[model samples]
Target: MAKKKKKTVAEDDLSAEDLGVVPEEKKKKTTAKKKTSKKKTTTKKKTTKKSSKKSDFIQSSCNVGLVGHVDHGKTTLVKALSGTWTEKYADEINRGITIKLGYAEAAVMQCPKCNRVIAEALANLLRKSKKDPKGHCPDCGEKLAFKRRISFVDAPGHEILMATMLSGASLMDGAVLLVAANEDCPQPQTREHLAALEIAKIENIIIVQNKVDSVGKERAIEHYNQIKSFVKGTIAENAPIIPTSAIFQANVDKISELIEEIIPSPDFEDLNEEDFLFNVARSFDINRPGISIDDLAGGVMGGSIISGQISVGDQVEIRPGLKNPDSGKYKPVITTVKSIYEGKHSLETARPGGLIAIGTELDPSNTRTDQLIGNVVGTPETLPEVKNTVEIETHLLEKVLGAEEDISVKPIAKNELIMIVVGTSLSAGVVSKIGKHNSVSLQLKRPICALGGSIVALSRRIHNRFRLIGYGYLAE
Candidate 1:
């Protein structure tokens, strides 16, 4: 019997073979790099590894959301932190705002000289903005070393993109709500984004007073008061507010330090390994135009694992999947996990926490253009039941969120079509029956495979836009 070869990826290179881009010479070069990296880390003074493919590397331990109003420096802050830009879509680039959910990962680095786990984003900011180009410790000026990693989910903050933001929130373990110091505190989307986080039940929150470079200390102090007033009695009332300048890379150390302190990763060590469930945040067909059929790569899905672990060879099923053309009914798609990725880094096994991409054995066409968004993936027989209807124990807010002026939320009316966000899934549901105890039955336009007791965000079409109204829990 032949032993199975362990495949690895270089930190700087994407999984070339996974994307069908590996030439024979490139494969040998990659193998040589892998061999060299093992010895390379050994030579380093426990400070830095030029290659993340080294055995000592670890993936991001949690997903932190970079969320706020449009043009409020969410992307700028992500770039300041991770050194990776999230805007890739043509429309997003032209519009200069996040439309689809964006993702990036950064390592929490410690300075070997300081012997303290200093803020890595601070190191990243210094690397990008300072004379040393290579990142170093802010304290002792020594080379920074890897400690842990954190993934960032950059969600759109436009008024019309509330559903998209809610969908992104489902993947977050914590969130950083950006409020521009130059603008008035509690902008419409700022209020709504915080409410959305509350609906999603994210307790680890950080409020970033971004763009502080454009404001005076007096104005900044007033805005700080407004921020304090705005968050009073809310879930984020106690969330530390860090005044920042995302454009100039100021106070990122504070942000990174608070993230480490507030957002502790879930201790999934005791979680049952059999209960494997993953939410599909984004899916793509990575094959470029005019690729040969023989070398075409399979579909890829990016998301975070909610529970258990997934292996490279595991068979996974996507539920509430593609609609059957003949009957217009949804059907599940089963595929094998061909490869897994944390950014460009490949992994043989994955557990819950960081955002991951699973390369699957499926046709690229089916997964292109995010056709598989809002689908739940799990083992064939282990996935939760698909539901066309759900009963939610509704909790209505006092007023509609994301509105210019406060608008009182009307009670759920019969036959009222509303937008519902469950995990990464978003669908329109008609209020079919309103029973006692605010139990509302919704006939979903699209079927969703979600577990019971999941938190669902509700929105109403106000002025031709879906404004967040409140949240509810799937009734038992």
Candidate 2:
């Protein structure tokens, strides 16, 4: 009976094979994905590949000036971005107002998933699960894109520093106008700065409603509406108003995004080919009193390049240089640039549209105390001609700005000496001739380094201060 059962089982197995039912293998097999070492090795290789690709990023390409009323926190906003407070002087810190043009630089990075400058809190929330320092947000699982760096020019908002603000305007590709959320929409300097921007033709602007932490959301919205009405029919009529708390850094990421969107780097084919034109605003003697002659550094000139490019070791000339006592002619100063500095970053070459400080091989005496201020620097024999007599087409405004007295603008009369600001160059000019409407010529007291088609700001001493009356372009 046992032999008969065994024979039957064997017959059944043979019959199943004949029916194409295959037997399964019982040996255990391991997958490469489950091997811990192999998985870690793959991840490490991917991370290294991403790290190598992130080294290329664009630095700052243009300068953005900060403008607003005094004590409105323009410098504070700069600090929030750069982590460096721009108020370097003791008086500025004590007085709680920016006295001069303050500069600071910051890089704005964008999120790879959303392509936005994520608010710090939001970014933290999104990246909570990611262990990689510069890796993607865990929520979106995308990396961060490093955008360009930006330089901020924090200009004084005091009524008296209108000329300095105007000069700073010349250096800006666009401007960020700050309006305090705790105060009224248009302060005196706020109005004046907007007017100055109009005169300077800086059309690209972003209005920041600052100090949001000091006000409720309702109050902030009221200020926002007020700002809209204030800028109605103005150059900033179409500009975006971003609400932020510069002190607490609320919505500061939006400021970076707005800047990138509004003021892009201007495209100019002649960035490297044209003759360089640098308007000197500030100069310094970096030497200490105890420094020896061998250790004394060359003089440094600070300002922005208006056009073209300059390089270290380039032979340059300063227009309206020291007057030659014997020849009675102003001989342009000939010097070589020992180094170039933008903010704290040193560079071998500098292009137009950012604050630049040139270290020149000249006596510290010439550049000390801003002695070389109001001068123009450029390649030798390539600078615009120095003009003591300039022909201008005047365009006077309808009303005087920032004046306690509500006075209508008076026409520029013959022999009327007025303050003229061309680029960063300041001069006093007498109206030598007046033709038809908006047509007038001036004989300047201090010569200006100017070319045809240069725009000049005209200021008259209204009461006690030089108020911007109008602007005109030089006749070619």
Worst 10 residues of 2 by lDDT: 19-28
- TM-scores of the candidates are 0.88, 0.81
> How would you encode candidate 2's per-residue C-alpha lDDT over 188-301 as one tens digit per residue?
889889988998889989999999899898998898999999999999999999888888777776787788888887765576677888888777665544445666667778
Error of 1 at 397 (Å): 0.4
What's model 2's overall lDDT? 0.76
Off by over 4 Å in 1: 1-54, 119-121, 127-135, 272-274
Could you tell me the TM-score of candidate 2? Answer: 0.81
> In terms of lDDT, which candidate is strongest?
1
lDDT of each: 0.83, 0.76
Positional deviation of residue 305's Cα in model 1 after best superposition, in angstroms? 0.4
